[model samples]
Target: VINTQRAELEALRKKESKYKKAQEKVSTNKLLKDEIEHLETELKTFEDKDVEIGSLKLQTEKLSRANKALMNDIKNEQKRYDFLESKYKELLVKYNIAAKDLEKKQ
Candidate 1:
């Protein structure tokens, strides 16, 4: 009877050890699943940020093009202003010479 009891105790101990190993495996699996979920969330966030970056880059390109066009317009306006100024100076000189001639004659 004692020998039979010892055998049963050993068998229970084996079963307990197996149960502990199974619990450890379950815990490790839960941790791995949580890690995978976290990584997936991070990946989604990165994808969203990438899309936002693309949109910002497109806006930047459009703004850059508009700025270049405005710069060109400014340059053209400056040239027109310089030409008008030159013409005004020439006309002033002509008017001054004509007035001096008229004064001399009178």
Candidate 2:
């Protein structure tokens, strides 16, 4: 009877050990699942930031093009003003010469 009791005790200890191992495996699986969820959230955030950065880059390119067009217009206007100024000087000299000639005749 004592031998039988020892055998039964040993079997119970083996079953308990198996249960403990299964519990550890479950705990490890939970940790891995939590890590995967965290990584997925991080990836989504990075994707959103990338989209926002792309939009800003596009806006910057458009502004640069508009600035170039404005510079070209300013240059054209400066050339037009220079041409008008030269014509005004030529007219003033002609008028002065005509006035001097008229006084001499009188």
Best by TM-score: 1
lDDT of 1 by residue, 1-106 (tens): 9999999999999999999999999999999999999999999999999999999999999999999999999999999999999999999999999999999999
lDDT of 1: 1.00
Each candidate structure's count of clashing pairs: 0, 0
> Candidate 2: where is the Cα deviation over 4 Å?
1-4, 95-106
**Which lDDT tens digits does candidate 2 get at residues 31-75?**
999999999999999999999999999999999999999999999
lDDT of all predictions: 1.00, 0.94
| RMSD in order of candidates | 2.5, 2.8
> Model 1: which ten-residue window has the lowest total lDDT?
23-32
**How far in Å is the alpha carbon of 87 misplaced in model 2?**
2.9
Tell me the lDDT of model 2 at 9: 93
